[model samples]
Target: MKEIWNLAISPQVLPLTLLLVPVALYWLLNLLGTLDLDFLDVDIDADGPDGGDSSGGHWFHGALRFVNATDVPLMFVLTVLVILLWACTMIGNVWFDASQSGLTGGLIMGVSLVASVVMTRYVVAPLKPFFRMLRADDEKHPPVVGRTGLVRTAWVDERTGQVEIEMQGAPLLLNAKVATGTLSLPKNTEVIVIAHDADTGIYIVRSISDSIPPQSL
Candidate 1:
């Protein structure tokens, strides 16, 4: 335990260790109901350029996109990335017996950052899907095709996801999924119910962008 503690705070891995504290705090607060984290699970939007300084505004968008953060929340992506980087650095430091203030440590840090991003981009792919499910009480699902809905989870892919459909009363939450070939849809994406599977009880959906006429799901 002491050796592990010492390595965690060592200079080579200190930055990632520090970054993890806030992430841990966020999860704790979320579980305690002290924070509304749903809003934080939002995707990056580059609908149009922010005019003041086009490059300045666009740079942030590009960076996130480069990291493939279009389908997941920025915080979610960062949290996973920080953990991966921390792991990579710790392993590298132990393997190399790297000194905190030297070039070897810097190299390990650099490699960890790149490796973490690449690994994280792939790691999040599974979480990006839309899922199909039926309500526990109901045996036969109702027809909701052509209805409009908004993505409610972090992302919607071919396998699993959630969408909320507004009605006269409270909104309805549906088990949403995309067709096998369809790309994953990010949170808050307006979608149109495209199809449904009776056997599976999963609703298939597509983004409103695919059927754009006045822009709505």
Candidate 2:
């Protein structure tokens, strides 16, 4: 245990180990509800031509092709890579202790880093299904038209607004706009979606609740 501890804290392994600390902290914070994974869900492929096309001769983009193919959230991939690197570095330090002594240890450490990357590439393929399942609840599913939602922004009008609707799997956040000529909806105002403009991708809403009328007694 002591030997492993020494190897983990050594200069070669310490750098990788240090990089993992913040990743651990982020996961802890996420579990505690202090962080949201929405930012990590951005589709990097969309920003580039042909949806992250690497065949265009950019080495950096080419190297990262596996990351986009993983389909898991970017942050999750980063976290896994950091962890794998730290573990692999520790293992290499132990196995090649004699060869990894003094200045030569740096070379062995580099090999461990490369090994970690290779392992991550192979590992992410099988993990796609698992990650999809893990993020299933958080994924942005199609908005249900005619469903009632509560305005979350200060005011919802023709130009700007946000709403929160209770979904079967999770709360769905959506950009909304009051139907033309309607008064702006204040925060927490219950509104029903009247129409969805697929081209514009915005929900047209009204403040009137969808309550059923009482039957005549």
Candidate 3:
């Protein structure tokens, strides 16, 4: 144990030892439950006629640009790798002497690098499509939109109400509502969705417009 400790604190292990800063910070923040530090904001606009960006500002439509992209996941991963490699090298140096330490450290580092690359490329990248698909489905058929059913309970003055909607050939419970207008539509009224509020996860609806008024009579 004394030899291993000495080896870990030696000049050969200086580079690896220097990498524990961000790793320690990450774990410390996680333990304190304050790790959600978002440098970007994602918002969906629903007020416009086309349900597009309502802000009309370039900043609102632009993609997230990180101030320091390398300060995030990459730094965290490298920090962990450095710490792991340092420990492995220390053990190798103590058990097999400094002569064999270099070779063993190189082998272990190479294997770890390859494993990290493989996991990132194959495992994480492939799961991205599945996550995208789930998001798309959720957006398309949000609990109250793109569904047809009867109102099971009455919606009185924005109070809570329930709707039984048929979704994907299955009945689903959904929150129901009446559009804010001059008049309030009653229960069991057939309606078509006009917009969706992402923050509230609410679907704004209007009575299906089916009319052919006399043209320039």
Q: What is the C-alpha lDDT of each candidate?
A: 0.72, 0.67, 0.46
lDDT of 1 by residue, 1-217 (tens): 8988899988777788998999999989988999887632243333334222244435665566566555456677788899999999889888886455568888889998999989998887665442112132332435578989898765667866668877665677776789899898877889999997765556899998888777476
TM-score of each: 0.55, 0.53, 0.32
Top-scoring candidate (TM-score): 1
Task: Work out candidate 3's RMSD over C-alphas.
Answer: 15.8
Decide which is better by TM-score, 1 or 2: 1
Number of residue pairs clashing in candidate 3, backbone atoms closer than 3 angstroms, sequence gap of 3 or more or interchain: 0
What RMSD, rounded to one decimal, does every model reach?
7.8, 13.3, 15.8
Q: Model 3: residues >4 Å from true position, as ranges?
A: 33-80, 95-217
Candidate 2 error regions (>4 Å): 43-57, 67-70, 133-217
When sorted by TM-score, best at the front, the candidate numbers are: 1, 2, 3
Clash pairs for candidate 1: 129-157, 130-157, 130-159, 130-160, 130-161, 131-159, 131-160, 131-161
Q: Better model by TM-score, 1 or 3? A: 1
- Candidate 2 residues 35-149, lDDT tens each? 8757424533212343332334234333554553325567776776788878876776677774557666777767777887787778776776665555454545775787888
lDDT of 3 by residue, 1-217 (tens): 7865566566555555666666788778977989863321122221234433243422321211111111123333344445555666555555555564566656655655555444433333333344334434554443456545554433312423345566676665444455565243445656554455554444555455322245695
